[model samples]
Target: MSIESGMIRWKNRVALVTGASVGIGEAICTSLVSHGMTVIGCARSKDKIDMLSNDLSKKGLSGRLIAYKCDVSNDKNIDDMFEWIAKNHGGVDVMVNNAGFSCKDTLLEITGDKMRDMLNVNVVGLVLCTSKAVKSMLTRGVDDGHIFNLNSMSGHRLTGILNFYAATKFAVTALTEGFRRELVENSKIRITAISPGLVETEFLARAFEDKDMAQSVFARCESVIKPQDIADILLFSLSSPPNIQIHDVLVRPCGEKI
Candidate 1:
């Protein structure tokens, strides 16, 4: 009903965001800090994590954001990351499974390696990480928590250029919804997916390699989005009343071509 200053008193909440080294994941970390929430930020790059930790300190957001180097693609690392979480900052109350990637390939260009790697990282990795987070929650006696999956419009519609990526995201959507239904029966855990259209971020920039091309992609996009936009949604989802659950949310830029 009423929201203020992004609910800047996430006082008692703990959030874990995977792939938080940059882009949408990084935005989620910073957004949560602004909301007065402490977060566990993970990525494979130690340098990136250190950078984020320092940034948090400089922003006067110290002690609220901790960084961990985690390679979600590995089951062992997944266990280690959550184990550290459980042993350290208490069990997470919210988990944001945003660690994902897409290779430069289409149906025609797809190779066994490309397709397999993409699926392994994007889909398999997500399931493993989310499972570990939930495990900690169960042990902590947290009857309820939140899970947010970063999905894409491709998950809902066909886009030839993104065939493999779409398949992985589609799987994520299904996984989230399926778990949401089951979790509602007992635990207070709520799982939801948010599909964001072409966003202006390093992800696209790195994918295109050329600034102009990346800019063009976002320019003609039905509506260019931003990482902060998705971050806002994450905050909103976590801030919703405990009994209320948002099943699936899709956001795109206006007038953008899909």
Candidate 2:
């Protein structure tokens, strides 16, 4: 019902967020930690996560933030990270699959190796992480656990430049539903897809390999989605009553046409 009512249910819970070094992932970790949740932020760049942890400490956060080095694309890394979470925190009650990327190359120009790398990180990595989270929840008998996948507008509709990235997101969309169907029948676990359009993040800079172009894309728009905005939406979804499931959420800026 109310946002506060829903959020109260998650206080002191354990949450694991991928790609927590920056952008949406970082925002989610910050918000959850503020809400008295123990958050484990995982990323390939442990230094960035460590920096965020230190910043949160200075702010006198109500909860804790722990940084772990993890490259989701690597199975060994995922295994080790999940194992550490299990051993240290018992298990995760929330999982945010927010690590993803796109390259500047088009489908025609993209190299085989690059394409495979994208698939490995975007699809395989997400699936593996989801499996691990679900298994942990089951083993711990934590039926009310929630998993959120950071999808995109490209997942729902085809965009010329983002076709390849869209393909990976579309796979995520499918997996979200598939997991929901399979899990709800037996467990109370919840799965959600938070799809946003044109977020102001490092995603564009990395995608284009040009800072100016990324800034220009947002500069021309009247408004662009902010990482905190997505984090808020995620908090809302996670706050819902155990009986309710917020399956899909699509967000965009006020003036965003697509």
The lDDT for every candidate, in the order shown, is: 0.80, 0.92
Task: Compose the digit string of candidate 1's lDDT tens values, residues 1-258.
Answer: 444443544564889998898889988988887667778898888677678778787888633678888888888998888888878888888889898888667778789987878887789888887777787788778876788899888788876666788899889888987887777676888787989877788776664456787788776666678899999887787777767888788897888555
lDDT for 202 in candidate 2 is 97
TM-score of 1: 0.92
Candidate 2 ranges beyond 4 A from true positions:
none
| Location of the lowest summed lDDT over 10 successive residues in candidate 1 | 1-10
Candidate 1 clashing pairs? 221-256, 221-257, 222-255, 222-256, 222-257, 223-253, 223-256
Q: Pick the candidate with the highest TM-score.
A: 2
Q: How many backbone collisions does model 2 have? A: 0
lDDT digits (tens) for residues 112-225 of candidate 2: 999889998899999999999999999999999999999998889987886799999999999999998999788999999999999999999999999999999989999999
Quote the lDDT for 64 in model 2. Answer: 82
How well does candidate 2 score on lDDT at residue 16? 94
- Give the deviation of candidate 1 from the true structure as CA RMSD: 2.0
